[model samples]
Target chain A: MTPEDMDLLAALGRTRAGLKVEADKHYVVESRLAPLARREGYPSIEALVAALRAKREERLIWAVVEALTVNDTAFFRDRATFAFLRETALPELSRRRKDGSVRIWSAACSTGQEIYSLAIAADEARNLEPGVRFEFFASDLSERCLEKAQSGLYTQFEVQRGLPIRLLIKHFENHDETWAISPRIRQAVRWRRINLMSDLSGMGAFDLVMLRNVLPGLDLSVRARLIENLAARLTEDGLLVLGEAESLAGVTEALHPVAGRPGVFARDPAYRAAAA
Target chain B: MKTCLVVDDSRVIRKVARRALEDIGFDIAEAADGMEALAWCRAAMPDAVLLDWNMPVMNGLEFLQRLRQEPGGDAPVVVFCTVENKVENIRLALDHGADEYIMKPFDGEIIAAKFAEAGLL
Candidate 1:
């Protein structure tokens, strides 16, 4: 891409959605926005870049951002993390909290798989606890992802990934072509649109926050703000779960990785915030 | 213990079905095709037969019909396990008197559920 094209795509990505595509990812940008350019009657990529630079079309700009957003997820995407939640976290939380209710938030639930996975775990845990209650809050910046998550329908191929056959029969209704999650599981989660770079007020506190597999791509400033906001919302005893590849050490001093728990972190009582 | 015959052209499927049935406390038997299964049934009756759709010499639907004709064969429960997952295929299998059906590539959990549904567990 020419200097103009690079500046245009980069600026559009940053301004519209706070996305930071590396300079070398022009190929990635070209592939994602190619169809959008064609739809807008641009003769080629060159023509589309020129159009974007000259006058921004609101819809066209959003399409580019949406296309670039990562929604690569599947049911029980990381079995180990879920196993930790099932085997260790839920039981410990149940013991600590006097109240029977537990609140959880999936900070970036792509299509609700992670939330539903948690539901399945919690439902199974009822065998031990008898009647513990669970409330879920799921959020994503993508409206399309939220809609799919709310509907709880998945194709055979989708169900085949990570979702076992036994769970499929128990938790979903099978149509000829697709499977719909049982109404109880589908209705259990509350969905909303939340851009991670945005503020965190008014959402209320959570006992367990699952912000898995989504931190690497963010700019440093956005990451710091989000961590501080998250740290403040998390209760003193609550756990903040990050992706397997993420670390809290350099990211923020307020949160520290809990001992022996691979991805689990908790508020650091001794942390002194950097002087502004 | 109740006896169950696992009928399939593939040895792997027969082994899998045998293991599943055995897990549920059924004495397991194996037959390679519908013809072999019929011959076995004439000799001795099983409590249930986990059957496959396409096999050499005789198919599963034919075996179910032929089994129904035999005096003691009709007593054994029949369940179809096949790649034909369409509703019409399932309806046809059930109409032909197979007690239940499970899709191919199933595990012991699926077998247990389908067996429970068929009242054979």
Candidate 2:
């Protein structure tokens, strides 16, 4: 393949694996990435792709992946999902847990929105269970996103999207015009860099997993592989949520759709039966 | 003032719904889940219910199904509050006896108009 063709394929490969890019929109990708290429001392996208393909340095490959992962997320991207989580999911999960602690994992959490939203959800759930112990794990593939997630700072526009005025007052302090997530909520979540393609055993099991808005990027094989990986970390009766647009259709046999909630599925009892 | 029950798991959404309804002279009651909503409805019948689709213990669909079976003087109008903007979900909500369907992150004026459409205003 030619240098340009290789660049296109690499971009396509990464984008399909949930690292974000509008590969079809070449000019837009080029414009957004030009500065990174310049900073990395590469003259063109072809040169950058060549360097990335050579894989001489792991850090360079990561930089390309980081650039490709679209971190375009708001405080609460989809309001209803969080609503369901706070009112229904957490409370129910809390009741089912033999231990007072509820474990929630925000898989592929980008820039802290999903995890922060979970913190807010957990706080809402706490209203029902005052002494509820929460173990929140927020993981992503990009170290850059993890740093931002760790910082817990958001722009005014970012805060305005799904954050309520009351939550703003209660959980965030104004850092000049930028809103900073409270230390309590920030501390509630433990952020880490985790590639979904790798082993997730060390993270332990979770009662609830928010895997929303991240999956459609993979091919059918990778999608199924990722779901199988995720399913292992979920408790037997645990809930697995996906983005409103994403689905488990043909992805994995381990999960079956929950009756009422679209894009939300649970471990298949039949699979459990077979395993048992 | 007309009483409206806002059933959602998210505090932010509940606050937003309450504020929107209150601005149009409606008293608001809040429920975080289906069981709480059903209990609240049994005790005090609100003029309307703003129900969310995907809640934890009892989701909106299950709540609607239960609410329909109960014997009450007058059943409150139920308008589904959701982010599932798909037409099929809306149709499902309506089929399950939801009077109307409203998408979330909506403007206050639109909420007020929904109340008016429901004749609660």
Candidate 3:
């Protein structure tokens, strides 16, 4: 890319809204965005950025954003986190809910891997408690990602990553080269296009909200805002999970880290007791 | 009895592999990590080594590299037992003097076949 393209990407990165595709990542950006640039009658990244700057069309801006969004997801990404969710969090939620219905939201759930894994956990939880009800809400900022998540089809390699064979056989069926999640597991989740930067009140309260592997790219203000926004939607006794590398330090005063579980925090119940 | 060194970080995987290898008449010597495996190899030369790719310290690839640098490097047939089944990983292991590669959650029959291929059977 030319100096102009580099400058454009750097500017986007400063906004902390873009992933900041660096000089080394130019090839990746070029490959992902080239087709869209070609279809728009732009011959190069320079022309594409010019059009994007002129506010020529919302579609072109969206195309740029979509191209920049890193959607590197696989089935059961981070097995230990899922294991904790299965062995500890879900059971705790089940016990706390008098109605026996547990709701979970996977914010920034790119390509639905995390949500689908939650579906597997929910299925297992339901088997343990026959009367337990579960609902999973999976949301992503990018419409393109939401589309992939809704489709719920993955390559054999994708499905095999971190997915045990027993869960694979139980929740997926082979469809030629791809493995599609079973309808029952698919039905358990509700997918929506949601911007983490926007208000989350309409999504309703949730027992658990997974914001894993996303905070590092965000600016401190945006990260704090996102946490506060999510905290409002968290059930009084809900759990908030960040990326393993992400921390709540200076992000929110309402959350206290849960010992032994990285990136996991519980709402301050004393505040609730005082309010009550 | 044929002796096999099982090198893995997970206790569950070690147990499973031990049962399979022992049932096929191989005596099992287990190591929790790659460094321990190397030490065990130096002390007692096993007929075969079942090596895991990822470990806390001294990963399998590094261990294999070091092992190949040692005297009688090619004496014991080394089978890479790992969760990472990428072709590149397999190629790297073979290039670094591994005899074979097996994906995780493997069956006893596959282990037997690998042992037979290594002339351990």
Highest TM-score against the true fold, candidate: 1
Off by over 4 Å in 2: A1-25, A53-55, A268-276, B1-121
Model 1 per-residue lDDT tens digits across residues B1-121: 9999899999999888888889999999899999999998999999899999999999999999999999987799898988776656767887788887777778886687667656775
* DockQ scores for all predicted structures: 0.07, 0.03, 0.05
Please report the TM-score between candidate 3 and the true structure: 0.66
lDDT computed for candidate 3: 0.77
Clashing pairs in 2: A16-A217, A87-B9, A88-B56, A89-B56
Residue-level lDDT tens digits of model 3 in A1-276: 776776676556435353545666678778877877898799887788887778747666666766676677766565567777887778767766746888899998999998898888867764245566788999987887888888889875576565654465567776554778898888888988776766678888898999887877565547677788888898888888877666888777868777777778778644333222
lDDT of 2 by residue, A1-276 (tens): 254644554565454344434435676566656777899999887787777767657677666666665566766556667777777777767766645888899888889988898888777665456556789999887787899899999865566556654465568776545778889899989878887877778878898898877775554456777888888888887878898667777677878877656677778554333222
lDDT of each residue in A55-114, candidate 1, tens digit only: 777766666666666677777666667777887778766665645767899988988888
Error of 3 at B81 (Å): 11
Residue ranges of candidate 3 with Cα displaced over 4 Å: A2-4, A7-32, A38-41, A126-128, A269-276, B1-121
For candidate 3 chain A, the 10 contiguous residues with the lowest summed lDDT are: A267-276
TM-score of chain A of each: 0.87, 0.87, 0.87
Model 2, backbone clash pairs (residues 3+ apart or across chains), number: 4
Query: For residues B7-117, could you state the per-residue lDDT of candidate 3 as single tens digits?
Result: 999999999999999899989999988899889988987888999999988999999898877777668889888877555566788888888766666868667656655
lDDT of 2 at A164: 50
